[model samples]
Target: MTAATPPARVGPGRATWVWRRWGVALRFERRSVLVCGTLAAVVALLGVLALGTGSLRLSPAEVLSALFDPDADPRARLVVVTWRLPRLLFAVVCGAALAVSGAIFQSLTKNPLGSPDVIGFASGSYAGASVVMLLLGSADYLAVASGSLTGGTVTALLVYALAHRHGVRPFRLIIVGIAVGAFLSSLTSMLLLSVSPQQAMLVATWGAGSLNGLGFEQLRVAAVVLVVLLICAATVVRPLVQLEMGDDTAVALGVNARRARFAGTLVGVALTALVTAAVGPIAFVALAAPQIARRLTRGATTLRIAPAALTGAAVLVTADFIAQRVDLPVGVVTVCVGGVYLAWLLVRQYRGGRR
Candidate 1:
């Protein structure tokens, strides 16, 4: 009789608790949306500034007008539509692609340092481009892109194969990648040395990864490749999340781990190749973007791919802006900034371990 009386309906308090939990979730979602919105706005503003403040210096209104009405003043139209817009688009697309690729690699390897650029894909592409430029004497964009894709894919396969004892271990993959990267880099240096002075100079500037010469054609190619790869990435996102669990759990959950890994590696390699072709070996977008996104999201499984892509786009566009204004190489700016950030990340990891 006492037990029956004690079963006072869990009515108002339970409802209140449910409501509070929902409210907390809504609040968290709102905060994430706000942060992402702010980031998008900032990136848009920076893009506008970058377009406006170059040697031509078009105002925001003029830039907008020129972008919309291509038949406007030919010079202004050309500067905005033909020249600056393509570069801006290239920076954004390349950045997003690289960032997404990095996030995929990091997740697959379960290593913070895992990225296409860090693991020698970019360097391998560079070597491929160098060979095409020097030996074949071809500056054709398609040829360069093809060469980059081949080089990066081959390097990825080699790394994977070398690292496969039973399965791909993170440390072994990294070590193999570094060793291969060094060998490819030395080969590139030798090729550069063998070429004529003019070719060498051209290669040197390209190697520094400036967004100076990219036109609409290059932008179009990069966009197509990026879109396709991104679509594939989206399709695989759920499986990839499952794959992040142990292999046995993933298998139990109906994930084909080996196939998923292969698909992810291909996508990652393709992205790196596209970026390397568009802008020669711009480092750190892939490395930094995912890390930044994870920090911003702060989820237990915080590989925010879309956010990472956006961050990468913002970083590259901003970096390109600085590079153009300061007359420095985009690669140089990225490496310097990325190096500092990487050091800070290492320190943070160390401190976290102590705690």
Candidate 2:
């Protein structure tokens, strides 16, 4: 890790590192790199703790040895390699995905509260899941996953349609998203109400969310989707950094604001949708991760996605560890903690007169 670098200059002929597709170049800060490494290390430690602290406990060293040595105890391997590893992996990957999604929205809207959860994607996903699990009476994984993807895509399109007049304005987008999100949440509630008691209870339990019983197959699917989205996110980061200087400035500097918004929103929604489909809506990871990442790296002006992604992984992995011990759904733990952070942010905003 080294000292952070300043922002990159953008133009037709000059760049630090230019992408092939346009006159796009990326700026990197060493601090963001350091933050990612530090957060990754933190996540690794928490992962070890999560694996070792369960009922069939093992030492950290034992965990490592078991991971490496193929001839290690079958029971140890079964628990660590098979059962625990999938959930642990999902915790880190999905956490990063949610945080990155949050960062994209925060940049687009210039609002700390802007996130997929608040912006209707999560509610849309839950509404989708409710349709499958409650209305269609199907608890199959494919059914729920397909429902979430379709619902999230439709919701994104709906929000875009409602927000776009001359073009999509970030403020209007957020306002419309919140409104749509509320409506979807209500739809979910109505579905819950209309279901049989047993079905409702099952849906409510899933709504609280869990990583339990997540198989490697699910991880494989999520990993593939996340990788593609992350690549898209990387490409859009340059334009997004320009967008922070104001839409007109971004356009003047050769960044297409509409394309940036479209790319960012699409990637962001896909990421959150993947997580929601996998583990249900783990609340507030998206809303808080980017801001936390910004603070961690002291708010790098270069659109700070890496740090945001790292911070998200740490938060979710740590939250999962706590959730396991407390016998609560990971969603509950995240929501409780996120609720406190939200309250504090609101109070601070009120005091700062930003409202």
Candidate 3:
């Protein structure tokens, strides 16, 4: 009882420890929200800027008025509502779709390089679209979307089948993906070579990825697909988080690893297919966005998916803006910008390993 009086004293160390833990948790939540909010804001601002500063050059006020008032100048309203709005929406939707796809694939494979583009899914979709554009001379969104889904799903199934031996192995999956991607790419090249010059040119330009001339219909299709996939992604979020633990641990915690993987892969493939069909396989948004989000959030990997989607939207919209101003393709701008970031990531990984 006498010693209890002395024990009532609070040490500064204990208070400091509690403060630090709480501070860290608070900081993390705030940072995540901040990052996501910043991305969203940037995307919105870019959309406004893109609408105003295109070839026709409407003021921001004019663009806003045109957007809100149906009775605004028909020409300005048509440009904002019919033409540019669709492209802007496509940029946002496709960016988010590709980013989320990359996050899911990276989580499933437990590798940063396990994105659709790296793993042949993108190439497969490209192959499918190429066949439609080059062989059948059809740019119909439905045809392209169907072909892309078919090609990407086939590629993913093959990779999964090849990589599965009792259970999927990450390294084997990556290796198989690279091999499959190479084969598909070669097939695409062969098809391009076999096509007539006009068809080849058309396919090649689309392959390089341009948002030019995209109308409301394409944007609407992509938006519907993206929204559906996003809902699927939400359902699997808890399971995915558990699966990030070791297989045995995840199973013990009641996560059906196989089911989770299947669902995640299916959603991921669908998203990738939609983006590829809509915009011709814009690269690196999927790969880079999740990585950037993870670094920014500094949380467990699973939390990065939404933030990645936002960041991807921002990156793609910004890139599209630059592409339009410079008279270059969206794909070209993304590749150049993402290539630089990717190189930096590789170097950072190398340095971390050394440490």
Candidate 4:
């Protein structure tokens, strides 16, 4: 009797790599591996450039030496390791988190526009952080992080409850998220109005989402938290992907659609909130990264988590690099670029619908 092949196989024609160990198996698409690797390399190269380019301008060699060689110049080490490394790490880590959040939401909603920024979660987090900043007058990391997380969690629950009717609908979720986000934004603005100019300015600059002045302390905590959240994300990702094949199909395949969606939503919210807490709300990485990955890979895979994340890291690092040259906040550059990308997406969808 012949043994049946595992379900993970994508059939005979596609290029796939499979690994088996301890009676377990893992399957990966070759193209995805290549693309993700290339994107990772791009991110690393960008990081090196970002670390190297500054007022003191070190070469790539100097950046590497300062990073690795203990005997390297103290000034070079201070500039690369002390001053620039944290910011670059923040960009990469936060960008990946946002992109993963975006991928999760977009998959759940089956809509390109289903991002945290579009669906009210980012606004909720910002509002939460703003509350801490203005009302509590606490600029402390832990306080702001707590407030942001609470706000985002509340917002997610609110959106989920509002969108639920028989079951949660993607279209309804998007509409409700937008409405809630707008309301929360208005409330945030009111809070800003109530604050003193100095306080308001602090909140405003934070809201603009700059990675300036962040250091090892913030990065260490944020990185550890993000890693934990990402591990949670990975656990839910397979079931989440199954759920994408429609709830009925997913259920038949032994997946609980509602449970998967719920868990995925929580992970996505946490990811966004963590970044918002650390660096404020960064726009468009979540929205654009997955779509960009899809196009770049020519829609070769339904699972987009890895590629989207890598693309996000590269995109944010590149944007931050540009931001440094222009002496602007990273958020401002993403807004300008992502605004254009969003407009283009809208027009494309409109044209497709008309046809």
The candidate maximizing lDDT is 4
Off by over 4 Å in 4: 1-9, 21-23, 299-303
- Tens-place lDDT digits, model 4, residues 1-355: 2333443546565566776766776777777788999999999999999999889998999999999999999999999999999999999999989989998899888889899999999999999999988888898999999999899989999999999999988989999999999999999999999889999998999999999999999999999998898889889878988877788889999998878988998899999989999988999989999888888766633347788888989999999999999999999999999999999998998999899
Misplaced by over 4 Å in model 1 are 1-32, 69-74, 351-355
TM-score of each candidate structure, all chains considered together: 0.87, 0.88, 0.88, 0.94
Q: In model 3, where do residues sit more than 4 Å from their true spots?
A: 1-30, 302-305
Model 2 weakest 10-residue run by lDDT = 12-21
Error of 1 at 149 (Å): 0.8
Superposed by TM-score, candidate 2 places the C-alpha of residue 335 at a distance from the truth, in angstroms, of: 0.3
Order of candidate numbers by TM-score, starting with the best: 4, 2, 3, 1
Error of 1 at 235 (Å): 2.0
**lDDT of every model, 2 decimals:** 0.82, 0.84, 0.84, 0.90
In the range 269-312, model 2's lDDT, one tens digit per residue, is 77887888788889999988888888877764425767888899
By lDDT, the better pick of 3 and 4 is: 4
Which candidate gets the maximum TM-score versus the true structure? 4
lDDT of 3 by residue, 201-271 (tens): 88889889888888986777778778888988888877877888888999999888889998998888889
